[model samples]
Target: MKTILVIEDDIGIQKQLKWSLSEFELVFAQDRQSALTQLRRYEPDVVTLDLGLPPDEANATEGLACLNDILNFNPNCKVIVITGNTDNSHALKAIALGAYDYYQKPIDADVLNVTLNRAFKLAQLEAENRALRSSNVAAQEIIGNSDAMIKACRTVEKIAPTEITTLLLGESGTGKEVFARAIHKQSPRVKKPFVAINCASIPENLLESELFGYERGAFTGANKTTLGKIECANGGTLLLDEIGDMPLSLQAKMLRFLQERVIERIGGRQEIEVDVRVICATHRNLSEMVAEQSFREDLYYRISEITLVIPPLRDRGHDIIVIAKALLHRFNDEFNSKIQGFSDCAMQAMMQHSWPGNIRELQNKLKSAVILADSKQISAEDLGLTAQSSKTATLRMVREQAESQAIRHAHSLASGNLSKTADILGVTRPTLYALIEKYKLLDLRTTESETQQ
Candidate 1:
């Protein structure tokens, strides 16, 4: 049964309400101090507050103060304020102060009961939504509290509900597929299939058939009709990994399907429509490839309607430790070990090491450490990482150097288009411009431009 804390000063009315609302587990308090005490004890989900209590029973001062206290204790709790029929100002004030609803005195149990039920239902719905989001985050393999990773998670939250083609650009092992799956999990078509194919992993000869399916008897061993990744993911999402490496010939076919949302299998006559949300991920610089005519310009535009640039692991500060600990816990559970935590040396080593392979490297190192560790606490040696470096550069300087190097890299990859470089660097045009000046990148930009022409 749901708990409701009723705060009423009048003894007779208090008894009346307790007897009337007997279906709920009831706790009653006659004044502000007692009400607050009961609030801490029961932690009720809803409260019925009378806005006229002792010392100021004739006014609403004491009652409003109690309402604020109740909300401060637990903001999610629903509070319904009871007032006199003409006490319009007090009722609205109670609501403004976070009361869920206002009820005039001379209560009708049936009507008030209906309102209370509605509040409980709403709270339940909100709780379920929070649970789903939590599961989705874990499913995406996302674990971090750092502001940079948090911003990336927030971007996932904002774009998860849409059907636009999203492009994820980052170095390898930065969890692009994880973010892609997160988007699919939060979409309306989550119940359908989520199919992913790596364009670079497959040979060019088989890549086309893998994406658009093959008709029966279309090739040497075409004994049966087969559905492609796109068709299999109908009403869901399709993740094209390493899209930059897709063959130039297939890029034209892929571009047509993207433009038309229809595909015709090799040696097939019918144009089959597949309703899949497309997400492309790549470490290779597609924009520069487009400029060099290795990738089609139209295809680049088609795949990157909205792009999410994932910051590398080194840029995420203590997120490295957070992710490592979580992975440690998971590995401990999987391997049936009792490792307590990381040694101080191990933690320091993690913070100092530059994770070139991002989360994948971190996960692999932890897995190997768990297998090798004999003691309860893991040490720096166990994780296959060395102790602190002797270099004298401050962390801030290291970050600036990394940022400068990345900007120069993107400049070369993007052929010095400020907009494309900004997109690749995951910054606004103004911020990229400031970085260019700060890093003395103007000469590099000029070199890139001269080489491009």
Candidate 2:
């Protein structure tokens, strides 16, 4: 049974409530202090707070204070304020102060029971949603249930245990580095160092030294022998972010290191052997660079032994909402704000906006919105997004997206079993096969033998 903390001071009314709310595990408190004690002890999800507690029963002073206390102790707790018919002002004030709902008394058991049940159901739902988000976010710090994201994650799981040279291709701010870290965490070299260096951020003159280190007096700044990123990440992973930005002069040396598994530092003849798994990421098209003779083709092929393409936020469909919600939960805790969720207009705006800057843009918008939001729910205006900025989706586009998402979701639920997926979608097997091929989801299709087994 769910617990409800009842803060009614009147003995006769309390007795009436005890009988009326017999289905719940009720804890009674006549004043603010006792109510807080019962609140801490039971940690009840729902509370019936009478806005007329002793001493100040005529007014709502004590009752309002008690309501604030309960909310402060646990923001998620649902407080249903109880007030006299004439106490309309107090009831409104309580609601404004974060009470879930307000109730007018000459207590109707049936009516209050209905309200309590609704509150309990909502609380349960929010709890479950939080758990689900936590699990997804905790796993490799990757959040999204979209088909594109699922495919990427599954590929990572399959390849993380191996020592393949992985290349992550994505648009800027699409979380390529985050995926690199996820691979490192899942790899057998997880306990070893995971070094990351942005090739684009470092100067061309110093990039070689940064990657392969130098001996004492190798250059003006080289006073002592130093281990480079590759050497430092020995037995672990080295992420070369924006690898497309690497200078052509250094590309040949990099390719040599990949092939030889040894590096000769600047001003040093000794070939120091190093064992490191290289993971490269870039927003630039290395293939075009190779075609343009700007990047070495051999090096590109070496780094891309196993490539994973991260989908842009716009292509991720409902994943935008999933990521936004996860970010909201995080920013709420960071800002200590009671922002419950996004408004309908805000959600529509998010869905419509083309996230050219991707996850980085989303994070910045949400962080700022959480801090500056005037209401409990964030509005489109709060995110600095307008309806005009959103692209108008065609009917065909919407239908296709919905169908793809539904098929992918069902396919996953059935563990790639086409017959089961078809059954779940209330479709024939042949129709399901056609739809899967239409969406280019052949990669997720199960073989006939595997399905039979």
Candidate 3:
């Protein structure tokens, strides 16, 4: 339970508060000195300061002084000033002095509890933001705690120490390069240079030269003998991003280099040996490309000696919120904005969106929102999301969609086991079959038949 420090001088009022706010662990103080002492002891996130204390109970002098003291001690603490019903002037002054809110003399238990709950929530959000800021200083590590992410990270840990040519398979904006850098950071060649080249972004003609370098006379305008990415990262790690986009003509040479650990620069006949760890990443399905005869099968097998598949943001569950908050904190510092956090609508929109562009899209949306947001909280509109449109979806449609998704997820987890799927969904096998049929999940039925076989 959350702790609340109540600084009130009236004995009867304190007893009434204690009885009403029994849900919280209450710390009582009749004066400023004891209030400060209790504050230091409990370090509660929230404090209720009655603007009527022992020495100056008739006036707001001592209570205001205590408010300043509390604020000075812990700036993040939410201090709700308790004042007389007609003392609007002192309440406004207390607010100006950084009090979270004010409660009048006639305090209703229900109303005070509501204010206290809000204060506690705000305090928690601020604390979480501070923690996220501290933890993401480097901003290079992978950020997710989902089972898929945990499993992928464990795989990276196991493979990083070895000199294996690993392949990272994932959708775009899924932080494939980040994982590559993580592997490089964990490996023996961490002190050496780490290089990355996007095969898809570079022209086919220039990609080979970029990877293996070119002699001065190899091509026109070739600056005096330049070292390529492979040679530049001789003793380090080289990330071949979007390797599936590399021209099929160059695949043979890539395969040869991978097999021999050597390369021949353009217009250079002699072979040059290079000691480097190679990591390849692509959003494309290389196996499918290999079957289509576009990507070389040998090269795919060679590079994918070890492969790690990164999970998409949508599948990561609460990690989306964790990542979104981390990004918010980072952008707040970058843009020097005091945007507190996301609004309820903004959070709901985020959770509902599929995140097709993943973290990159999230970062862009947040950066824009932080720069343009006028309010303390980022609303769905500020994030360029339409939470209202989702409300237009009929209740029946929403329920059916949710049910279909749950059944599909449970079916996947159970690996086509009808009984196991039913158990996971907390339904009978017949009910599961009925729902699957109603949802027209033909693939699942086929999988069930295959499993039975």
Candidate 4:
């Protein structure tokens, strides 16, 4: 049972309160000092305080002090102040001091009971909401700042309202499932279930049964009546991941269900109506599969009412940096590491390299780098990227390399004509003279008459 602490100086009032609040384990205190002691001892969920307490029953100073102390000890604790009917100003002051509520004497039992119950229910609801918010943050863990990702968010916003079937087309590891969940979260059916089934993961023989379920004694292992994924996702969404891998025969049945909004269990003669919004995803080119006569054309049309193309990570500008920071936070929590962040060289290397497997490849590399990194920050070598060697190894060596290459290339291409070389390179005559001065290519810079054919 919830505990309640009462701080009232009157012995008669304490007796009445204790008897009235019999539903809870009530603790009584006659003064501010005793009330604070009981508060810490019991850690009660609620408290009732009478402003008339010892040391000065005429003033509400002691009660107000106790209320502040109780709240400081446990911010979630609810405290109700009992004041005289005429002392409306003091009641308002008590409220501003963070009392949960106020009661004016003579207190009505029914009114106080309603107030207490409301406080308890509010606390319970707040706890539940906090838990739900934490779960939402956990589910939305994927992060990126690319233009493609921004467009994807917009597409989600547009299609989440209507009851249209969506097809997510992307390469493997390009986060098709993440986008699918995002769609479901934004849809009208967010409160309902979102069932995801991979067509390619299950064997061909069992795929139909998995999608459509089976009746009792339908097969050797079918001991009881079972509902299919479509039925399970009624009033919500069903994600058919890798739909391109579904068998040709089952594809026809899936199309029938999409059209008719009904399904039949395996070895059952009854047609059960189902309400489900279908969302499909596949990495393969469905058009080619249709041309090859492997996939049904009718099914493709049913699933692709709205198509979303997710660009691979390589094409998304500056997304590498955004993704790196998110992955760092994730790995830090996962491995219990105190690593600060990525090094400058590491960021440059990530920008330079091509992420062939897209986001999945980046995730794997960061995981390894986090585990193997000796210093607080991850460096380019930790990520196994080779530093560019052609740049400045030294200043004089760089100048010599630059001059020798420029002179030889210009001499070879121009064949001893300075004006022709400058014209061919699209450089101004004076700029060409600067190069000739710097590289000491004066021999190549013969007179203009010598340059003429």
* Most TM-score-accurate candidate: 3
Model 2 TM: 0.62
- Candidate 1 regions with alpha-carbon error over 4 angstroms: 1-140, 389-453
Candidate 4: regions farther than 4 A off? 1-142, 387-453
Whichever of 1 and 3 has more lDDT, that candidate is: 3
Q: Tell me how far the alpha carbon of residue 380 in candidate 2 is from the true structure, in angstroms, after superposition.
A: 0.9
lDDT of 4 by residue, 187-257 (tens): 88999999999999999999998899999999998999998898999999999999999999888899999
Q: Candidate 4, TM-score vs. the true structure?
A: 0.57
lDDT of 1 by residue, 190-274 (tens): 8988999999999999999999999999999999999888999898899999999999999999998998999998779999987
lDDT of 2 by residue, 199-297 (tens): 999999989998999999998978999988899999999999999999999999999999999999998999999999999999999999999999999
Per-model TM values vs. the true structure: 0.58, 0.62, 0.68, 0.57
Q: How does each model score on lDDT?
A: 0.84, 0.87, 0.87, 0.81
Question: Where does model 2 exceed 4 Å of error?
Answer: 1-140, 388-453
In angstroms, the error of model 2 at 155 is 1.1
Q: Candidate order by TM-score, highest to lowest?
A: 3, 2, 1, 4
**Backbone clashes counted, model 3:** 0
Deviation in angstroms for 307 in model 3?
A: 1.9
List clashing residue pairs in candidate 4: none
